[model samples]
Target: MPDDLREGRIVIVGASLAGLRAAETLREEGFTGSLTVIGDEPHPPYDRPPLSKQVLLGRMAADSAALPMRRDPDAEWRLGVRATGLDPVGKQVLLADGESVTYDRLLIATGTRARPWPNADEAALDGVFTLRTRDDAGRLTKRLAAGPRRVLVIGGGFTGSEIASACRERGIEVTLAERGPGPLVGALGGTLSMLAAGLQRAHGVDLRCGVTVTALRGNGRFTGADLSDGSRIDADVCVVAMGAVRNTEWLAEAGLAAGPRGVACDAGCRAFNMYGIVTDDVFVAGDAARFPHPLFEYQMLSLEHWGNAVTQAEVAAHNMVSPEPARRPHLAVPVFWSSQFGLNIKSVGVPTFSDQVVIAQGSLDERRLVAVYGYRGRITAAVTVDMAKWLEYYQGLIETAAPFPPGPGAADGRPLVAAFPVPSNVPDPKGLFHGPTVALTGHLPDRRLTVVRPAD
Candidate 1:
């Protein structure tokens, strides 16, 4: 290993889960470098998953969701200060407060922010909200406690759906509008999405599919919303759960392969320059990184899962201090879970990346089953509704690239063979109102390699 990799200045550009985990792993791996963590938020790293679930439901406090540190990394913390720019050649990160930090190695894990409502004026209304940070969750929690007459959620993604579920749990009338045919269509595809729609509707959610919120009606406070179908909804609160926008604007002129999607990187976590050249000193991880995965035919995957952040950060930290021969690839199978409408939905691998899906265990009619996804006869992904126990088994099949339409014996005691597979019906990325939690951005497994940029 190089001496500089062991003892040198290291700066992490995000103080969130990925950055914190990377710093801890670096110290654990014997990297005695001068470490610094930069964050835009005023508080230390906190758990975001609960912000939409327990926090909004009043089961947990927003401020109490701080992530407990495994060990002190003994690094300088720059909280509430944003990194304004990056000078890759100069090896310095320019901050918002006219400060710069030089580093021998840099970890870019700035992550993403909630995409704001398109109209700035309408978004500023009293009841308009978007949940991403602790402050956002705290404000929304207070608002929900006040018992608004009706809550209108603009997008039917996971966050939006969860918000609606919370509203329903509070006995508040909630209307969810989705531009697609059903909820979760962008991530789980059309088949499972149908089940999601049914669940939402069955649970007292006024689920409106194939409709867009054309305008928000308000007078200092939100009153209602105009829909595309020439109908107006009277709601006192509105949540724009459109999705997230990658935090890569600061690196726009840095010449890195960064854009709206995310910063491009190799499977080894090395960031790529604008010319597509890999740089050794700089690495990327978490939701802000798009890296290729060999298991998915080397397609560059952009993941926003909590597990991905921890595993990828560890891999990046290991590679940052280890020699090329000892560096390992970040090949962890993508996994995600959601709780809504009294159903525990979990998925392994990229469900949208598959072309066909089969019900492996339980029946969809029962609303408690595992749906296995495949592409060209290869098991690619699996999704379960209240059937999380088999997630690990399906994950192994995906990791091994097991044959799709898996054997009949894999099911429970029931002798159920692989059912006839149906089209997954994944939507086009451009048409999606919300970003997918797991996105396969590179070429298809059967297709040749191609460079896919955010613009393309």
Candidate 2:
């Protein structure tokens, strides 16, 4: 190992969960380098998951969700200043404040921001909001506390569903609209999404599926919304949960493979140049990185899971300091969890990457079950609804590439039978209205490709 690798200037953009963890990991790996973390936000890194759940419900203060530092990296922080551009060849990051920071190694953990509503005028309405930052949560918390007559949520993804759930928990009337068949259909399959729709409606949520909010009809403040189905919803508040946009616009001319999908990277978390060539100095992690996963047929996965941020950051940090022979791949299976409508939905692996799903344990009618997803007869992912105890078992199955429909006598003590398998309902990326928390990007492996070719 070269001593220089562990003792050089390492600049990390996007002082976020991934960035913070990477800084800590670098220090833990004996990297005595000069570390600098730049964040556009004025506040320190905070936990975003709670912003939609506990914080919005008033169970926890929005500002109190600040992420606890495991150990100080002893690095300089450029808070409230955005990274304007990247000079890869020059090894420098241009800041919005007209300053440039030079670095030997750069970590692009810029992450993603909430996608704003397309209509600028309507989005600027007084009661309209989007949840992504700490301040956004705090402002929405105040609005929720005011007890609006009704809350209209524009999208039915996880964030929208959670927001609707929080509104309902506050005993506030909430209407959720989804362009798809149901909530979470883009991530979990149609079968589970049907269950999700039922769950939301059962809990008094105005679940409006297969419809989109065509326009927000508001003057100075939010007054109502017009749906595609020719129905008008009268609500005082409107939340645009249309998903997130990766923070890669600043890297547009940086000669990196970055765009709407995210910055392309390798399994070791090394970033790729514009020509698809891997660069040694520049690396990326978190929701901003698209990396290939062998378990999912080597498809590039762009994940927004908290677990991925921490694990991938550590892997990136380790690889940045270690020699090539000792480098390890960031092959950890993706995991995501959401609490809405009194159900704890947790998924192991990429459910959207699979083609078929089967209810292995319990029943969907009972709302306590483990659904396993498979691709080519192999288990690829599992989603547990109020059955999280079996999450570890399913995770192991995914890690080992266990056969679909699984065998009997597993953790739950239920006979694993191949129930009717249904299409996973993974939507086309082009038509999607929201970005999924776990996205299987890039080309899927060709199942028919063989090593030997028949002579034509």
Question: Model 2 TM-score?
Answer: 0.95
What clash pairs does model 1 have? none
Residue-level lDDT of model 2, residues 217-322, one tens digit each, is 8779889999889999999999999899999999988999999889999888999898888999999999899998877767888998899999999999999888
Error of 1 at 41 (Å): 0.3
Candidate 2: 10-residue stretch with minimal lDDT:
447-456
- Minimum summed lDDT over a 10-residue window in model 1 is located at 447-456
Error of 2 at 167 (Å): 0.5
In order of appearance, the predictions have TM-scores of: 0.96, 0.95
Q: What would you estimate as the lDDT of candidate 2?
A: 0.88
**Residue 201 of model 2: what lDDT?**
92
Q: Could you tell me the lDDT of residue 18 within candidate 1?
A: 98
Please provide, for model 1 over 1-456, each residue's C-alpha lDDT reduced to its tens digit, 9 standing for 90 to 100: 137678899999999999999999999999997999999999999999999999989999999988888899989999999999999989999999999999988999999999999999999999999999999999999999999999999888899999999999999999999888888999999888999988888889998988889999989999999999999999999999998989999998898999987999888899999988899899999999999887777878889899999999999999999889999889898998999878899999999888999888887679998999998888889999999999999998887778877878775665553458889998885566666787777652423443322211
